[model samples]
Target: MSAAPVIVIGSGLAGLMTALTLAPMPVVLVTAGRLGQAGSSPLAQGGVAAAIGVDDDTSLHLADTLAAGDGLCDAASAREIVGRGRDAIMALESHGVRFDRKPDGSYALGLEAAHSRHRIVHVDGDATGAGIVKALVAKVRETASITILEDCRALRLIKRDDRVVGVCLEGKGPVAARAVVLATGGAGGLYEATTTPLGNLGQGAALAGRVGARLADMEFVQFHPTALAVSAPRLPLISEAVRGEGAILINDRGERFMADQPGQELAPRDVVARAIAAEIDAGRKVYLDARAALGEGFVRRFPGIFALCQEHGIDPARMPIPVRPATHYHMGGIAADCDGRTNVPGLWAVGEAACTGLHGANRLASNSLLEAAVMGLNAGRAIASEMTAATVRLEPVSLPQMSDPAPVRAIVSRGLGILRHETGLRAAICALLPKAGHDDAAAVALAMAVAAFARCESRGSHARTDYPHKNASGTRKLFTMDEAFAFARELAASQPLSRTA
Candidate 1:
């Protein structure tokens, strides 16, 4: 393949938007799965978080994000993202995305948890991600300067000294470029049950770390409060918007348990999910009943969720929907600035793969897509500007072969799911490290292990029973590859011989 001006890993919303923003510049978009299938963007139900309504302001949006994040959100990053939300939403609209509107031509807004006002702009009720991805993919196809390469997974980033040269793909050797953008989504698929696509396995974070990119807040993973508890191997999401539209959580005894919690069904995701999990742990079946609250309008509005419920033989219009906590989004990734530039020169990251400090501890509902668009745009522009000032050269690098991911997946799911203790996490790290040794899957597992070990306190999405108290330090934790390697080695040394590889 010919060397391009920029190489963007993953073809979801963020990667596509990053390429689109650099219009007229030669760009290559790579994906592990087919375009629009690997990331959670296509599975998003609630709309993007934007201050499109007259009642909504950037300040209000920022306040909601900070409150939902439980005091860990960076005020400046929150303000910047919320301030730019309208323009990003308008840009998506300009690209032929059809957002739902009121009868009087105003944008129809939906309310979600921790938000004081209606600010979410969705499409087709549910399936906002689908609508956004469709528009983005269409724009990408029409752009002559952009090339889409499907079934190509980025293995590792190539770095010479402190600068990233290019990335090595699985089947297609090293495709070099002046700049590289890692938008390879999250690690939800690392869990046994998750709403994320099967390939959302933290490859970008791993790739960046292997190249010595600084990673931040890797321990904080958001669990959606209400994923449908189906018999399928992987769990499916039941959108938070459903609760916003008035769904009530009930136990097998027909008790509305959420009434005992703060904000009831409208509580922040971590709070609500824990409550549901507690109910299940207490041997009560949990159900989300929206029949009385939403009525037939539920079927008309959220047709995607409605159909999913029908396929499971549970009609939201008739009875309650069974729900459980499912792995949703990762709040940590390769640490980057607002412009998406990593510590390594010629390397940048955006979307779910980059920890831009926008979603500090926990992300507000639907804010991810907005962050992806805004940051992707900024990254693309910044990379283009940087390339203009220097000569471009393509450097080739070799990638190591990977082993089966089944073992690592099982280890993460059993030891690192919603609730974690020190023993389980340590054991998990020991079991996984050997299997992941020097391979792509191992690199990804190492990042997750390092992050999980660093954060001991129970806060937001990452709850530890051993360290139940929230730490007063409150400083953001960042890790480099060397630091992570040292920590992993130390842990391995402390463990028994059987645990070590």
Candidate 2:
């Protein structure tokens, strides 16, 4: 393995920030598409979470993050990440990111659910993600130390003995690197209904698994509550910022449903998602009534969403927008430390693909972007401080992609969607167990299904409808790819899993 140039996989905010942090040092970025075009970072609408206002403190932000995580958040990681919020934002600003500012020259911080203060730093009205990505992409293109490899998807890890040396890409030779960073985001694309790009089918997790990196909290998948229920395949998101601006969730009877719940319209995202799911399951149509909340200014405040609604023949200023729950985020991934180093040497992970325990059971609103920036920068700095330069040989290893992903995707959605039951998860395992290694997609799907089935308790984003109460053993679930597949095989050979938990 070479130890001179660092290699970053995935070109979302995390990857870009990491490469930018290690500027003046040679780095290579491998993306499945053009930079900032394929991943969920550019699709983020809500502003990044931070503790920048005078009324807000990092302690309060940490508390909200822990509360949302359902006791799964690591206290130290939460403190470290949330504690660095202001500096992260300032660092981005220095790189040409334009955030919304008040007339007094301070930031116009907006509020999202689960926060006690208005500390959501936004830009171009509701285009916080687009603004950050645009600036970073421009900065990367201008930098001479970074090499952008567009249209290259990393299919597998090139490991020697126990450590990852490089990656094998689709239709290409193995490229050696000193250190490899994974920022491939989430597995939401495995679901038929999701807000993330369709290509995010958990390939990164599978790659890490093949190299024996420990994956933790694989059961907690966070479903966003308010995807616009247009008949289209991929749903457009209705920003939670719209709800923060006073919009409310309502049912078919034109009643404010969230009024009866804690935090009302601004409850934790898990609670709100479940509430909406329950409404839809009960044959009631759910809608976001924003006409009375923002009126004429809705068009100006959210021009992108407003235009999306208009294209679908709905007017947000006059009518309630139909909404439903869709798989939005994965809180579990490659288990890594605060420095983004995985258990495997020379391999690191960050962003949604890394489970640092900062977001335990559920992520707080808009914290995804914050985690991306902070952890990406940390990974870059950590590797830069320790990398050793040396020459090495490159070896390409044959790895398998998922075979027949459609059936696996359907099973995962039915078994592991908003509300999960024992029967559905087991059946999903039985169907997916046979194709585990042949398809990375099926392997990742089986891993999540098995973890969800083994948890046998409800907590955070992982709600088990059968075991409807939280248990005292609030331990995190960890796994290896072989371990997960072995369990699935044994269980599949036995009698079917009973639903009488």
Among these predicted structures, which one has the highest TM-score? 2
Per-residue lDDT of 1-501 in model 1, one digit per residue for the tens? 444568898887889889999888888888888887668888888989998789778888888888877777777877887889988888888888999998999998999887888989999889899999988898899999988899888887777667776778877777667788999999887877788876677888778887788988888888988989997766778888888988899999999998977789988888898888899888889999999988788888789999999999988988999999988999888898877888989899999999888887788888999999899888888887777533435456656776667777787877777788887778777777665556555566666777777787888887888998788886678988668777877897887546532
> Per-candidate TM vs. native?
0.96, 0.97
lDDT of 2 by residue, 1-501 (tens): 334578899989989999999887789989998888888988888889999898989999999999999988888888999998987898898889999898999999889999999989988888888899999999999999999999988888888767777788777768777888998989998899998888888877988997899899999998999999987767899989999999999999988889988899899888999999988889999999999988899998888889989989989999999999898999989998877999999899989999999999999998889999999889888888987764668755666653767877888988988788988888888888877768888888888999999998889989888999999887888899889988988887886654322
> Model 1 Cα displacement at 451 (Å)?
2.4
List all candidate RMSDs to the true structure.
1.9, 2.1
Off by over 4 Å in 2: 1-4, 401-404, 496-501
CA lDDT of each prediction against the hidden true structure: 0.83, 0.88
When summed lDDT is taken over every stretch of 10 residues in candidate 1, the lowest stretch is 388-397
Q: List the residue pairs that clash in candidate 2.
A: 402-439
Measured by C-alpha RMSD in angstroms, how accurate is candidate 2? 2.1
What lDDT would candidate 1 get against the real structure? Answer: 0.83
Indicate the worst ten consecutive residues by lDDT in candidate 2: 492-501
How many residue pairs clash in each candidate at the backbone level? 1, 1
